[model samples]
Target: MANWNLKSFDDIYSSIAESAYKDRPNSFPKLFNKNKSTEIDYSKSKKDNEGQITKGGGTDLPNGGKVYLQPDSKKLLEDEETGYNAYYVTDTETINANTHQTYFAIRGSDGFGINLPQIKKGNFKEFNYQDWINNDAAFALTDAIVPQAKYATKGMKEKITELEEKAAPNAKMDVTAHSLGTMVSVQGLAGLSESELNHVGKAVLFDGPDTTASLKKAGYSDEKLKLLDKKLFIMSILLIQLVCSIVINHGINN
Candidate 1:
């Protein structure tokens, strides 16, 4: 038979009992210095403590504690020349929440950051058959215009108009996008009038599919194709190197 130590159990119980006693209410009267003012003397006496009376419960003055003051709002405007305008327009779901679209008009200098503007209902009016070609429709009237694969809905053209209006009206603006965003950005920019194009500094596209055949057909240079092929070759080499490095690292870890 195995024997358990009774002495060990007694020690454990004693330690727990000591801990509980220490955590219990204070057993002695709190001490005070004669020279220092007591909180009781400073406070207004409310009720007499059993008649003969204690002066008061405590001082009305708060104990020294931390009070945090809010930091001042910094100015948003940046001071710079030759800077481009930028906008981070929220998608439609958010636009529906406030019953208006939030248009952020940002430029390199002054008047920077997000601005929420309520676009009235029916802001995007439907175009008549003539409006599609001759009127002030956002997109072109051409029958052969290819629908960009990235933009699945017709509502995208409305969004483009909103972005254009909300951007810095006087400053140069450039549209940029990643993946599906590139498709819409390019189409929107292409539809702009010649005057609007002058204000546009540059457009950046990332991982985007082919543009409409007409857009390319206007001018597809051999030099551009060679540059694209060179980039693809470099990318292939880098990908292979990355795979080899990953395999080597996995073997080392094992």
Candidate 2:
């Protein structure tokens, strides 16, 4: 988004409108190769305990909780990112499970990271279409802009409650959310009773927006939620990376 200056925006718009617009040969896709992976040194071997990173660079989520996921989930995990204006959103789906608890991860939207220069601060609405945007934060947060956040929250709450009921009595959930995923988690959880929220054990948010107002409006207060214990944030503009992949596995084990 650093290249989102007035001239660059005009260039991209022209590139889309005019096929012959070649003065600037670079298209939006060319300028930002979203497929490019972030560089970081990683251990090639698996660490001990409930989780593992397969040799293929995929995450091996932990199981042994009360919920359920695919049979092969322990052997394979993939991170899917959006290319264009696309979004990977869902109501609810199990990441992995066991007899005592479950583990679920929520992915954020497909837009620029929190570091988007245009958004000096505040939610996406403050920067762009705020008038008619409404509660579209939940969907737009996940890059699913056509649907609004209220509907998404409803569907998600239903899914979470369903999972909670299906699992063993007092079954717990360990949540990991990234970007818009954090909003989804908070909104969905806010709809649940305090007892239900207690079933949620731990949460790890990766660059997710602070949805305090969003949750409070939905009837979830800090006094109501009480789920922020053991919470950690990563890659946030104002916070440090207190939670890492190891913390994700550890959260599940606890």
Candidate 3:
């Protein structure tokens, strides 16, 4: 396995997130060029986990790791009422021979690429853009436990619990999420128990709205919020540009 690096993992996680919207049978394999060492795990995959609506499967990384599309992935895609999707990937390298590292690549809002007018006209029953829009609105407007966040919390907890039971004692789990997924991830992480949170290593979120109100509404204490803050590493392209612009303007004024 290659040496562990955040940049390399970030690239892979981003690709996995984007793959949620793709409708191809070989989408996962194509990402890794279907290397000879690559293995597709189909024991739990249904119908090769391919379809226009619900797509899922597993692939072995070239570097001896494995990536599995959680079963909830298909449910999240097929059910408009729920807005959670994720892919779980094991790290190529472990901290020790007995310990392992895993990552959960949570997907953001989909349907952005769909034809809105056609969808509104009921041309695509399988792709519900309105559900995604409603999730976005829920993240922006209300603190009422967003269904998507609830789903995300449940999904993460289940995976973490399962891994804990099966993997080595010190196995570590990380999270990567984008856009609406960031909100989902934050609420989900906040929902974890102290012991579960301890197992979580890092959370890298991208371009998501602030979730303070939602977290507070969900009864996460300030102390717990502080703990979650310590683990989250948020990256926002727009925020970076704004900071750069402010710095440039300040220099000019001086």
Supply the TM-score for candidate 3.
Answer: 0.64
Question: What is the C-alpha local distance difference test score of candidate 1?
Answer: 0.28
Please give the CA lDDT of all the candidate structures: 0.28, 0.36, 0.58
What tens-digit string does per-residue lDDT give for candidate 1 at 1-254? Answer: 00111111111111111111111111001211223311212123322222322122133222111111111122111111212212322222222322122222221111122232422443332322221222112223332223331221222334344445553343333333333333334444555445444454445443344545434553435544333322221112233335545655787899
Tell how far residue 129 is off in model 2, in angstroms. Answer: 9.2
Q: Point out where model 3 deviates above 4 Å.
A: 1-16, 19-80, 92-99, 113-127, 237-254
lDDT for residue 222 in candidate 2, whole number 0-100: 71
Deviation from truth (RMSD, Å), model 3 = 10.4
Q: What's each prediction's TM-score?
A: 0.25, 0.41, 0.64
Which whole-number lDDT from 0 to 100 does residue 11 have in model 3? 34
lDDT of 1 at 215: 46
Better of 1 and 3 by TM-score: 3
Show pairs that collide, candidate 3: none
Decide which is better by lDDT, 1 or 2.
2
